[model samples]
Target: MTGRRVRVAVTGMGVKCPAGNDPEDVFRRVLHARPTAAVVPGLAEAGLPVRFACTVPEFDLAPYIGRREARQIDRATALLLCAADDAVAGAGGAVRGPGHRAGVHIGTGIGGLPGMEEVVYGHGERPMGMPVHTVPKSMANSPACRLAMRYGLRGSCMTYATACASGTNAIGEAARRIRDGELDVALTGGVDAAVTKVIVSGFARMRALSVRNEAPELASRPFDADRDGFVMGEGAAVLVLERWDLARRRGARIYGEVAGYATTCDGAHAVAPDPQGAMAAECMRLAIADARLTPAGIGHINAHGTSTVLNDLAEAVAVERCFGPQSPPVTAVKGVTGHLIGGSGAVEALVALLCAARGVVPPVATTASTPDVGALDVVLGAPRQVARRPVLSNSFGFGGQNACLVLRPAP
Candidate 1:
């Protein structure tokens, strides 16, 4: 098993985001370049610097979980659970096997932030009184633990907290385990519910949020010359990964193959990306190499375009460095969904897979300004049709954490 490399198949995916809940619906919304960012009901009244966000609209837990059980869990955990249920069901029920052969890997930048805020500020009559379930609900690993318990998976249950790269790292690590024969099945993705007052205000203080309060839809303009910053978003995405052979044997509907993955760090700045994007380019090259393919094989890139000035520029530079001036067309989904933080990578990965399978790339929403970063072919205005080929998805985080995954259309 040391030198062996087994393919990992993405059999099922579920998403709950600002665009929609169902994966297809969300994909369609993005394909049409419909922006979801809008002013939160009370944010302006709260006097926050940023008043707009892309939030999961009208989510009810009663349909996905028992009412009593939902009461004990945080919104983040509940979101993950709902997505997990959909993913498993989409995978033709659970992957029936020994419990130890399965695992749960979930990622989140800040877990249960709303729940923690409630505990700190008191809920209803309880003034600063901690609830018994507060600890479990607020824990970063709660999503993974709860998923494992719900599905009876006894293998490793892990959570990644690498800022925005958390989801990509979790999915990449789970694929590595399966490729190394350590696990047969894994539930891997990311979720974050950080739309609380504290989280929003914190990012606002950092000046990381877009202030296009008058027109929230146009706020997240990735790679656009007028791009200022990102808009905070909340959502969850889960994917069911299984060994390629096992998936074929079980007759699962494979969406795509997780062909390669690589992660790297810049070690340069805590919040700013390296202007040259040297390490980011290296991460992409490494992932391509891991997939046993060259840069020429990549069809397009699903950029980790956070809509921030530095991030979009750095990513543009990285693309140029990785694939040269004639790089494949690039698209950023953050313009449609805003920045989902930890969940952005997983959701964008799903979009990449969809692009590969459907033979088209969605337009980067609401970006009217010319790209300031050289001659990169940024997809805009309308979806671009292309040959079905492997797609490279990127996720870069605040602490210089960068992760890349290459997904190929199902054979």
Candidate 2:
């Protein structure tokens, strides 16, 4: 424990994205610059503040999920479990045997909100009676439990709800557990299907959602001066993480190594990031240090670019402050995936892994010009192939919950 260097290998992967459900299809779609977001069916007629979202369409859940379990679980957990199958299967089915060797650390920002909102907002329903499976299913831990039960992972099954940072934190914590010798493999990622009527209205009230109703696909313009706010999006991403040695021993397909993880707090603002973004920079620095590297080692970054003005700027500033003018290629996925809220980081972390593995930088879409573009290498227009290896990924939440992860191509 004292001397052995810990390396977290991402062996399996799956994506339940708007463009596609299958991981392979989604990855190809992203590479080809396909659109995944559109106006949801029959929602615009209801006059919801946000009319469009990145939704998986023409898809039957039963084919990928069991009808009995799907009925009891929220869509968030359902998608997570579906994605988990591909992930563990990618891990070479080593999740078998004593469940204690495996764990589930899935993250979600809004747990059962659509279902919970239905029960609570239904004025016709009785005031006191709880839904048959309200508490357990609506709890944030539900996704973790459902994932664990679905995959027989009995160890460290839990959930983290750090707003948009939730998924990344869960994955980071899972990496820690494996590094600390608590588990050998983990199903790590995030899911959120909470883009509901009430949730959209809430964001509209706060003006945190893009009002590009007529131009839904062109919304979520991160780092652009004209960027208003992030468009709400929903999806699930899953990655099977294992100790590098174990993955190599099993001859599993490796995506990347979870080389470093660092989380910090500003404690300066309730919701807004510190304008200086010093603490955020430190998080990146600390992550690099944990990976036993320096700022110059990073070849790319997957930013927590929510398409919101402040967030994009703050993140850009933080990266520059941390890595100086030599900041590597920076890319924002929110523009394409929309903002998955709690699931943002974990899903984007996968984008980072892909960037390092495939040596292609994902382009930030619908973006115009950033004031600090000179400092940040914002990948745009097209996917750029670079000699990328270790990349930094960031996710900052409302309560100052910020987690940075350094991932590198599999050695």
Candidate 3:
């Protein structure tokens, strides 16, 4: 419907992750390569194979929402609500009124897993006293619906559930809608609170989770030669995207521009990525092209590095295929925050924007061993200074879902 798409500006961001709640604090922790993985409070007694995870520490919803309202929602919804509150506030409360065409788009892998596990598996035969709001809270669209209701966003309220790529896809889709002039403002991000016994045990049984119980903080070594598997992490991240002109008119503090976005499917496997990473490479190239940029234009890459042997190798190959021997410097936030599953992409997107604005790249905290893929320059140990340019953030998920976003520094 257009020749050149409208630019979407990122005006506000909020994060509730293992690293921290504030965006700046989280980025600082990531820059320093601080690891937050630790043993879950009750996992050891629960007898699960994997006992550790990167959990949001001491999160309380009372400050953001009333106690009565918080009681009806699940942990995932609570996290999203908290992040959304911060994001909306940070955006100077511009999208709240009924006059604006606002929307809510959220991504989540398994929404309300804790509630589902409790009501479904916890109650054996004691006449399960399910709460009235259990069904609503346990639904996969709970977070998105709750956010929309809270903000009074009247436009399309949608939810994406592409396993781990949920958050990135949500942000990309929302940006597209705004760029296409379908919406004036949007709250888009990813959130997941699935560090439950069922999820952890399932991953452990599949040999997809790290088994380093003694030293959980050092367990998630993405792209490292000695890396075994990813450690589960739970968190939420939300960003406020607005039409560039609207943001400028309002004098909003622009963090960056969502220049281009692309989503692709491997169509090769249900759980494992194609070792060749052909589709993944194509996705990256498509996103860069959509942004009117070339491979050489991208300054850095925030890899979808899950610490799993298969994912890291596949992603590395994809990067090499996309940019050849001159691949951009790469960093994996999973090393510090662990694998946030659906929320990882959104948080990493924020990190990429910060990197571009600050002219530096953070390190992959635990990746000390030689990188399995020697062709790529994986940032490690210390932050690397670089010129501000477009940053490519990647998110690949189960069932071969891949999403990429090209974020350009604000002019």
Q: Give the TM-score of candidate 3.
A: 0.97
What does candidate 1's lDDT look like per residue over 1-411, in tens digits?
145578999998998888889899899999999999998866878888899899996877777899788878988898889988899999984468899999999989887777878787776566546778888988889999999999899988999999999999999999999988889999999989888778899998988899988899999988889988999998999999999989999888999999999999999999899999999999999999999999999988999988898899999999999999998988999999999888898888888899889999999999976549787888989999999999999999999999999999996
2 versus 3: better TM-score goes to? 3
Q: Which stretch of 10 consecutive residues in model 1 shows the poorest summed lDDT?
A: 120-129
* lDDT by residue for model 2 (1-411), tens: 157776788988877767567766766666655555688754587797778877754567776787677767787877787777767766676686468989989888787777788778763378567657777777888888878877678889878888888888988999999999899988889888877888878878878788878888888777877887888887888888888888888777888889999999888877788877899999999999998889888888888988777778888889889989878888887777788887777778877788787888877777767775458888778888888688889999877778999999875
What is the TM-score (0 to 1) of candidate 2? Answer: 0.95
RMSD of 2: 1.9
Instruction: For candidate 2, list the clashing residue pairs, or say none.
Output: 164-341
List per-prediction Cα lDDT, in the order shown: 0.90, 0.81, 0.90
- Superposed by TM-score, candidate 3 places the C-alpha of residue 79 at a distance from the truth, in angstroms, of 0.4
The sequence of per-residue lDDT tens digits that candidate 3 reaches over residues 185-243 is 99999999888888888889989999989899889988999888999999999999999
Model 3 spans > 4 angstroms off: 97-100, 126-128
Each model's Cα RMSD: 1.8, 1.9, 1.4
